[model samples]
Target chain A: MLEKAIKGSKLYWGWIGLLLLGVATGFFAYTFQMKEGLSITGMSRDVSWGFYIAQFTFLVGVAASAVMMVIPKYLHHYQTFGRVLILGEFLAVAAVSMCLLFIVVDLGQPQRMLNVLLHPTPRSILFWDMIVLNGYLFLNILIGWVTLQAERKGVEPPKWIKPFIYLSIPWAVSIHTVTAFLYCGLPGRGFWLTAILAPRFLASAFASGPAFLILLCYIVKIFAKWDPGKEAIQSLAKIVTYAIITNLFFLSLEIFTVGYSQIPSHLLHFKYLFFGLEGHATYAPWMWVSVVAGLLAVLILLFPQNRKSDNVLAMACVLVFLSTWIDKGMGMISGGFVPNPLEEVVEYIPTKLELLITLGVYAAGFLILTILYKVAVGVKKEVDA
Target chain B: MRANRRKFLKIAGLATLGWSVFPNLLRASEGGEGAGHVRWGLAIDTKKLNDEVMEKAIVACHKNHNVPHIPDKREIKWLWKTTFHKAFPGQMLDNMHISEYAEKETLVLCNHCDNPPCVRVCPTKATFKRADGITMMDFHRCIGCRYCMAACPFGARSFNFYDPKKFLKSEEITTQFPTRTKGVVEKCLLCYERLDEGKKPYCVEAAEGVIYFGNLNDPESEIRKVLAERYAIKRKPELGTFPSVYYLI
Candidate 1:
């Protein structure tokens, strides 16, 4: 069915061409980083991780959000999701690929990345993260492909596939939880030490991942001329509304704890992110934008009329996507590092090369997403005819 | 079937014995002969540490280790200097007299925690805690993910963002120690190399009376004596890393 990706309209080829160009440029920047080291990036010794890890964190949430569709379709037997569930699984495949790519690009020794497997330490959260992410990527690919093949043939998926599909539901949660453990289990990082971090990650992931999927459904409707169905989209919008609200509620609880306890080590990180810490507020603007956009998204999504309208729902999903992107991608990792353990604020701003490499990874992910979606839609159209 | 069962029981018994005894044998061999008996520690007499004394110690350690002198935030230092308040942020008090202590420059380095978070978070065991309680790094094995840096509460770990050799002059390079490549995390190994050579760490040698280095497990060691007689405090002690380094305030 990959042949379906090859035989697309001029617009599809053009999009594929653009993505290839992005991959080429990112590879070019990466060679420079390899030669000169991580100096080409904006990370200092103070903020050891920058844009690459942040993007990895955000994309992990996106990957994990496939469960939102998986749970409703498999457990609840919601038939509306049957048409769109493959799209969600494919999105997870792409997102997990991006997550892995972001990690590789961020490494100072990308060449030695296999060492994580070779000299695996069971105690390291990163070690578990590697296991869970790869497991998730594999699960999504196997389930999405096998089930879609059965759909194209107009038969129920084989019995063996059922266990795998059910397993993916919890595996999705494990991927994000392990990613959170990569931060929360660390001793001195005051910002990430919260026990609620995994829950918060899941809530934000559910909101952003589904919101992005809703937008993708619209794109499929226009481009592929196959509606994923309005009922499916509306149900997703409701999921986004509840998830985003939960995300905001979790954020408030974190704030209340930090504010009431008044522990300077913990309080300082929030101060740096929300306000200026010692006159350096690099992320403050971005954080406020995330906060305002999240609240506005919730307000827009709350009403029944807004959910019914395609335009309003799209706007709200975009807001939800943007809001979570900034919160997780921009603030979360850097916030933990800044006002660093010693209480010194060293800012991180991604260099052009870093941003280019990041764009390359995103393009790579989209390229995968496009090809997968093309095959799924092509199969759907064939079966419908 | 009876012969096979007898053989399995013998093999299983040997395996259990090897599991228990081999670890002890391996631990004994790890930091050289009798290294399992030593838990190396440092006690810094901050009151005795002036700028000149601190500089000598920092310079000695850097010179011996071939640590580059990068003059920016990207600078690498196995040992360095900072203010008291910065070193111990959790200990700050709201009084003018206490604020004076905040301005006093104090020496800082890797605490080489007994329960190192860096060791716990390292994906590849590239950074590890030795039998002698010193945290060591194997640069060749590091994937440079920098998770150890995030785990270190002291901000002690430094990633080689650039090829470290570039910053060192030909004359400044120490042939005794290998210069690190870019993309690996490094920090004060607490002079494990010197300890192996039966010599004090270069910093201890340079600032003789100010910094005490000894085997903490030995009750009569100088570090233990210093701890007994002085009011020394370990940084972020509440976090339970149980840092091997202590500061005499």
Candidate 2:
């Protein structure tokens, strides 16, 4: 099965070459950053974290999206997701790998990551996040490998695999929830110290992850000639519709609390994100784009006729992915840092080096995603024939 | 009081663990809370902090610690000057023209909060509260995540973004205190080495009556006496971080 990837068309090799180029560029930039230290990046003391951490936050949600398919198939007994389930699980594995890489690139001391394990401070949310993220990755791989082997052999998956599959449902939610706790519990960061952040993270992850999966399935249908099924794509679109609505609702709840209370510390970050703080409105355009894309996705996804059409469905999913990508990748993490601890607004803009490293991580994820999808599609194509 | 017992147990636990497992590890991790028997604190009289004394005190403190003089983009400061309004934005008075302390330049450093959010958020135990309540940073252990910097409410913590050694004039760099590396969070450690040697803090010695230093847990100490006599105020008192620094306004 692994050898199947070696035999590919010119287009496949070209895609791999493009991703390889991104990885090499990122690696070159990272070596310089390692020697010169984090100063090479645009992050300052005031806005401490930059592109790496923001992308990490967004990818964690994408990793958690695997449970969207898991819940529908195992819990709800939805047959439509049976063929699509492996794709979501593989995405989780690749997404989690990217999340881990982003963290490494973000570190001022990446070499000292083992300190979390050695020291093992349970009180710290970062310590717990490490545990859950790795645990989620482990569970997904075990479930995916064993189940795929059983499918190939035309036999039932072992009884032992069932319990792990069940356990993964909650484990998926925990990864993103724990990640949110990393931001939420800090006392001074008023933008992040909200109760709704974890719920909001889960809602957005469910929408965006499956929305991307919808597009991926279409790509597979066109390129690999693997039509997962029309019903499968439609069912996932419905999930995206409800998930985005809930994500929007959780965001409004946050807005209401911040707006009604009118506390300067609490409301200042929202002002910075949406309207720009102290005339640094660089993030405002991106945030407003998210708002419009999100609203448009919801409208398109809601109507029965629009959602059923392949063209509208494709457009809706792209908008949904972009909407959440900006919300989580651009706004969620940095928004917390806008007004630094002293209530001074210090906006962060990513340097070219930072963007290069980020792109490198995304390319690595795509590489993992490409290989895994190729294997899954090959296995499915053989079984069907 | 509860935190005292908790920190003591943690130290004891870590001490025993270090003895059994990581004796070499403890040697590198020496910047623990200073003079651990009592809660160390300060009470500063703003009226006494004249321009000459403040400048002398700041210089002494920075010189003793090898605190680098870097550019604005990559600044690394332990003690510095800020305006009264900037230091205490929440406590600003409407009629600044009438208030004596309104326009005064405030001496600022790490608040060394009783409930340090930095210690709580650090992935590694690189930064932790010692039993005496002085928040300590083991630069050896700091992964430079800057989570501690973000968690600090007073904007006290600074990261060594660039190589500080690059900017320091060789003659000016002190040999006594080790300069921090390029990628680690550092802050006012309340002069951990000086406190260990039974010497008064450099700033406290230079300022004379302006800066008062003593054990807060000891009721008979001068800082406690100042707090009892003067209406001293800590920055952002309502936040419940229980900052050890107090100002005799």
Candidate 3:
């Protein structure tokens, strides 16, 4: 598996090199942040969490979305999704690893991070988030590797792995739900106080996770000269279609509840995100882009004709991915902070240092994705040969 | 795929059962530090809390705790004065006439809730409530996640974004309360250091009969005495934090 990534086309090697460069740059910025404390980033007392935490939230959904493929294949006995399940599992392994990194970098005292484990408080949602995320990562790595080894050997995967696979389905849902509790359980932050938050997180996760997988299959097809089969892609597109539509539907529910009730504390974040709050409408434009992208993604996927065409389907998948990224990664966390506890409106704009660090994290995730996909493809190609 | 649905069901059920049961085992381990003491609380008489009196009290607390006077963007506070409109938004107004309270500011500090949300949400037991109903922060254990800052409804907590001593006078870093390092949350500990020495809180000592601190559990204590006689209110009482502090408006 490692050897497969070692041998690659010039483009593949170039991409890996670029990602390494990104990781190095981000590591440098991280050192500066560590030296000076969080003041080096754009965060303040009001906006305590910024780019790092938002990315952590978004990637947790992406990590959880690995189940969309797993559920259809293992539960419903969909043969098409079985071919692509390896891809989803690997994507999750990468996403969860990235999610962990985001948590590490976001800490004010990285050295003291072990304190969470040293003094575990299960009452704290964060304690549970740690438990579930690491558990999911280990589960995916074990299942994905064992199953692939069995495929290479032309034998059925071991019986022990089957129970773990079934366990992962619920485990996936728990990872995102526990992450939602991190925000929803907090008493004062009105923007995240809704009962729908966990469901909304799952809905958006189901959309973005599978949507990224659809794009990834094509990337595998083009670069590695391996096709997961059109049936697999089409099946994934359908999953993304429903998830995106349901995600948008959930967003509308939030809009209705927050807008109609007109409670200033509850309404303020939405207004600040969609409109402006006391002249600080920095995120309004980005929030609107996400809105339009979400609606357009839903419309494109609903049509069976567009769903069949690779170009339109790819476009729709990208649209869903982008919009979900902005909605969760940018707007949701920032919105919760604006009109902070004191009813004071303060906007968060990520510093270059923060953005560079974030870019480094994404690059690292991709590097893992590339290698994992390479290994999966190598094993499949060897089996065919 | 030769999958037995029943076998899968058993495995899935057991795994789910394991996850649900494990956290409770850990949660049951959590308990307050140093049991068996009366709960401490504050009773503030707003009638005696003028702008000058509040300023004097704030300065005294800062001097005692070595709180930094940082720039507004990076400001940190433990005890401060805010207008009644800001502190008690959408409360006690419409039918009731606007008394002198509408214009005058109210003194505020950590409510040190009987159920502090900050303590509940902190990933580490860095922030925990003492058995005496005092909320305590162990700066050494804090990872600076700032979840406590978000969980606290009163805006009582502050993060040391910069080392607090940077803005403090050289002499202000006193032996009374240890200066907190950067990247840890800090707030009024109800002068826990002074309480240990049997001395009154700096704010209580500075005020003349305006600030009262005593055991809430003891009916004979000053805070309980004030609560018995005066019409008092705690900030956001409807939220049910059970704030140990009270205000006699």
The prediction achieving the highest lDDT against the true structure is 1
Report the C-alpha lDDT of model 2 over B1-249, residue by residue, as the tens digit: 999999999999988987989776666477544445678887879877878888888899888888888766557778888778767865666665536665678798988898988898888899999777779988888777788877787889889888778877789998998988888999999986887777778989999878999899889998888889988878887778899899888
Q: Could you tell me which residue pairs clash in candidate 1?
A: none
- What does candidate 2's lDDT look like per residue over A99-175, in tens digits? 99988887777887788888888888888899999999999889988888788888888999999999999999999
Candidate 3, residue B123: Cα displacement in angstroms equals 1.9
TM-score of chain A of 2: 0.98
Count: clashes, candidate 2 = 0
Question: Sorted by lDDT, highest first, which candidate order results?
Answer: 1, 3, 2
Question: Model 3, stretches more than 4 Å misplaced?
Answer: B1-35, B92-96, B99-103
lDDT of model 1 at residue B204? 89
lDDT of 3 by residue, A14-88 (tens): 989999999999999888887777777888778888999999999999999989888888899888877889999
Q: Is the docking of candidate 1 incorrect, acceptable, medium or high quality?
A: medium
Which pairs clash in model 2?
none
DockQ of each: 0.75, 0.53, 0.50
lDDT of each: 0.93, 0.87, 0.88
Residue-level lDDT tens digits of model 1 in B90-188: 686665557778878999999999999999999999999888889999989998999999999999999999999999998989898889999999999
| Candidate 2 positional error at B131, Å | 2.2
Error of 1 at B96 (Å): 5.8
Query: How high is each candidate's TM-score?
Result: 0.95, 0.93, 0.92
In candidate 2, position B223 carries an lDDT of 88
lDDT of 3 by residue, B1-249 (tens): 247888898899998898787976655466433344679889899878888889989999988788989886657889998877667765634437655575568898999899889998998999998777889999999999999988998888888877777788886578857888889998999988877667778898888778999988888887887789998978887777899888897
